[model samples]
Target: MSRLMRISIPTIRVVPQITPGPPPPTVAEAVERVVAFLAPGNVAVLTGAGVSTDSGIRAYRGVEGRYLNPNFKPMFYNDLIEDSPRGHSFRQRYWARSFIGYPRILATRPNPTHAALATLMRTSHVSQLITQNVDGLHHDALRTKDPELHSRILELHGTLHKVHCRAHHTVLRDEYQMQLALLNPYWAELEESFRRTGNKPRTNPDGDVELEGVSFDDFEVPACPECQREGKVEMVMKPEVVFFGETISQQVKDRSYEVIEQADRLLIIGTTLATYSAFRLAKHALELSRPVLLLNLGPTRADGLPQLEKMVVSSGPVLQEAARQLASSRLSEDANLREVLEGGIVTSIEDV
Candidate 1:
């Protein structure tokens, strides 16, 4: 656990400790406009892959987004649920990738952007942090300072930390599936060699990496623990996330709408809003007459929506600089409300 797990109202002295980053001139005008939106201090923040890229995670559609690769095919719920089996090559391939990815994901730390959001939550500028990311870095940052702050964030897509038995609907935490893969003798041997060589194959946004010159057949996979314990066989265990082609739970969708509807404004950070699940939140905010600020490096499905107020092409610098500015500038109700009414909207980076 890092220091970010615990977020609190740090004293004035803390500001001087962390170097204050001025918003880049490229994004200065946009940041100024964006900081205006934060004036109301009841923003519902929606973050996506772009926010985490600074933390070393590649997104699906940025300049380096995985989607642009002609050969890349995202994991689909239908394929995982309907096509793969315990002995199928798909299962073997998934585990192979997990072996490469699990450690990398674990090694990822919350960057300044994540800390910035945590600060916003601490100051109450952000009413709630709604994310399409399942990385859990947001929750991890807020969890340390105040457990209650952790609850204010909603992970629209489930996290990768959990594993579930599709058949039994039982869930386990940590790296159980990966552990099982290691427990298998043959797979374990390959894993050991892969680690010893330090020549990791290329990996994608999904936690799996490529296994060059490796054969998938003859790999043995274990059944889920819950089912195995119950005398059942051939059960499949999957990361308990909302995979592509899957529907988010109705309860989650309703709760998200409730959050968006209640917010004074919506802040979209680091996402293209390509997925309807995330774009719908922006759409709903507009439906409720709420001003929406979308900050991403590229175009989004919400590009033409009249409801969108500001769209910043940058995420980390603007967010970090703005959040830091807000931390020092606004602590009173009047200051917050004043910024809201001033028409602070970041149009696009092109203007700058």
Candidate 2:
């Protein structure tokens, strides 16, 4: 666990030049301007669920609506460890769904936004990407394509594809098999029920599942491996993900702050900066007098902040264009592709 440290600084107001005189700028042009604003070395990127929406994932909240399941609510970390009946039941249904749904999620492909960010990293325009998304799409993108410049990504919300024991803290890459066999022996049957009824279980952005009529008594929660060594083989429980009531470990929070502290400029995309746990870091950046560029469809809580440089647009094209421009300047292959894909010299709405 890392200790908490605060950097005290006053906020400075920066008004970003909003283009309104001409036709709307294409995604590539928007990105070019954003890229030009960022200097080399230690730039920070904060991404949200909107970045993954183009890849088939849905945003939980938006200007038009908030997507939520009426039947399921998130289970907090304290609730699970305290052995609440609802928590146990929730975990059972969650793991049950993971058995059926994990593969479908894994099969999802990265969208233009992800590819663009990867390209930016390759071209040395970005230093670190701090994402609120748990889908692991950024990681997937990196694995598929080896970028020229290495950029580190920090997952603030925790990854969906990982499970860890609360007691021993041993992380599991694919615990669906182990959890299914141990926690809910009848999961297979229940999953069939879901399939037959065409009632797909609802999950939050964090990937926690919700189901009705399930009881904890009918399931077995697994025990920690270390605890089991002492004659207690309890069912090890994997909750949907970090829930609302849970606190992101101090270590994770501190590391995120470190990145904010070192950042010269902050690029915020796809997030509304709604959650305090996630929003506080952006607030910290504002305190340090760092410039923040926001790219999202809806309004953000941080939008009202005096120092935020905001752009109301979809991130998919914005990032793609930015990547294209940065890559073209440095890599010959990227230059050729940029010309073909963009159809001549890319121009911003500001330029037009």
lDDT of 2 by residue, 1-352 (tens): 4544321112211223232323445666676767686645367889988887776665676543243333334445555555666666666555555665554455466677777776565555678888888788777665334343333788877777766666645646465456566556577666666657766655445553445565545555555665567776556456325655566777778889888898788888888776766678888888999887888776566756787777767777666666665566555655534433332222221111
Worst 10 residues of 1 by lDDT: 1-10
Alpha-carbon RMSD, each predicted model: 11.8, 7.9
lDDT of each: 0.66, 0.63
TM-score per prediction, in order, is 0.79, 0.77
TM-score of 2: 0.77
The alpha-carbon root-mean-square deviation between model 1 and the true structure, to one decimal in Å, is 11.8
Residue 219 of model 2 has an lDDT of 54
